[model samples]
Target: MTNKPKPVIGITSGDLNGIGIELIIKAFSDQRLLDFCTPVIFASNKVVNFYRKTVTESSFSFYHTREFDKINPKQVTIFNCWDEEVNITPGVLNETGGRYAVASLQAAIEAFKEKKIDGLVTAPLHKSNVQSESFSYTGHTPFLKDSFGAPDVVMMLCADNMRVALVTEHISVSAIAQHITAEAILSKLNIINSSLQKDFGISKPRIAVLGLNPHAGDEGLVGNEEQTIIAPAIKQAKNNGILAFGPYSADAFFARGQYEKFDAVLAMYHDQGLIPFKSLAVGEGVNFTAGLELVRTSPDHGVAFDIAGKDRADAGSFIQSIFFCADVINQRSEYADQRSNPMRKIAPDVVSRLADEKIEE
Candidate 1:
């Protein structure tokens, strides 16, 4: 019998000046993480070392590699981009750090394309500091989408069991009204539905779509967007057998524990979804990019410039992101393996029957 290969998770260190390196070091230091997947950090050795010394006490050694063949699971592996030289200060942002950050992300994307890694988890990066004019695409979601030729992508933030997906991300509040359309909402719903089923192992996913206006337009008294745009999209998605329903008022819905009823909630804009989500799961939230050929997730928070070098950055979100990536990869592998073996189908039924029999006793 051949042993299955362990899933390799590629992690990109975001901005050198921020807490990206610190969180990366703290996350990898947890020996418990190695039980699930092999983690490979796509970064430079000097940057990692500098953060370790400045932020926390270092115990583990990082094996620096220029090629995939040099990766070793027993040691924390660092894939050196060798992109450029930068004197990485703990709390100051620099163009050199930005350039290296972009290079690290590009290297990870190439590794994913080459089938060297199963999924990718990224740290936060500064948009203002990166060197290339062409890299002006907000955050990692758009960058990854354009890199892989995926025209449509959705950003979902997961906090424990509850999940919220954004229909429009990284756009201004003024532009959101123009961007909200039936096609756009339907596309995001499809991506969320498919992702919950395939990646999350949810057999039948239930999605809730939030309204564009307060009180869901109060029957068109407050705003007509819920009637003219959102309701039509929800109806369309349901007609296509997506199990989608909503146009629910954003304020009252979350306050009433309505989010627990669905597997994922689709918000019309960025802050409309994220504000409540972060309030509920601030330190533990993990941001996941859906609708990509490859899986990508990140810590939901940004660079804490105030306490960047103070050793006060919490690694909870970063740790959760790694575990979430591992869980998704495992589910995908398990589903594929079951499809290859017909006998595995009966295992669930057999277990169910045994449980029923025991209940009668």
Candidate 2:
């Protein structure tokens, strides 16, 4: 059989002080990874070697390049972002590592903007230290939203089986109720629905939305948000021909496996969805930024400061992210093909009427 075209996946080496480089090196060590797609690391070769030497005795190497033209799809390529030598330390938080993380990320994003890479797989970044004068933002999600000029995007966490999205992310718990209006919920629901179809290749996806309050507001006894805001949003979603449901009690939804029935779930706040998703995902999930024109996924976990140089980081999620990006890109291509040359999927009633007319004729 002939080989299929592979997407060039650009990788941003996040926060050099952490396990970002370790995971990036370990994940790409396996030669079989190149069979799926090419990976280009956006970091200095010196930093990558520092992590490799600090953590391992192995001799894994990446071809260094000055520009995108030098990329080879069969092996690893390090797109040198930093010119001069920089301090490379493990498990130490400083401005140097933080600057490098954002530098690498920004370079990879520019590569993405130029269409040099198909998808991006970013390693973990320290939220506190990664802040720079030019890169001051809550996190990657908002920065990416502004970078791409997208009006809105969803912070979705995806695993093999479970997918959960947040309505309000990186915010205070007290601020959640204020943001959980009918409009916000409906907007998230719509984004989820669209991403499911276009990004995830789900046809008429079923989404379950979680409520803001305990027991989903207890029908106004516990709170009024669910009864007034959430339910109305669900109503609007259904009316818009979206397979949306819920105002489901967040506590009971996952307790009884109610999430298994749907393609995706929308939670009211950060912890409401993430706590359960993390507990259930068991360190195997991938944080995907849904509703963007490009595909981006990162290791679900964060910068493991304590275990930075231990060579103990698990590259499972990172590897899965690479494969998932490939799958999502393929799914998107197939979805576009189907849309452009849609299949004969007429409504059942319309088909019956046509059949009856033919018989009568």
Off by over 4 Å in 1: 1-3, 338-343, 355-361
In order, the Cα lDDT scores of the candidates are 0.87, 0.87
- lDDT value for model 2: 0.87
Q: What tens digits encode model 1's per-residue C-alpha lDDT throughout 1-361?
A: 3657667999998887888889988887777788777889998887787777875564656788888997887677899888455687767778866787898899999999999999999999887787477698888999999999997989999987589999889888889999999999999999999889778988789999999988889999999999998999999998998999889999998999899999999998999898999999967999999899888899998877777878889999999999998888877776776779856766878989999999999
Model 2 C-alpha lDDT per residue in residues 153-272, reported as the tens digit of each score: 899999977999999999887777888888878888888999999988787899998888888888788899888888888999899999888889998999999999999999989988
Instruction: Show the colliding residue pairs in model 1.
Output: none
The global Cα lDDT (0 to 1) of model 1 is: 0.87
The TM-score of candidate 1 is 0.95
Off by over 4 Å in 2: 1-4, 57-59, 343-361
**Candidate 2 Cα deviation (angstroms), residue 209:** 0.6
Lowest lDDT 10-residue stretch of candidate 1: 52-61
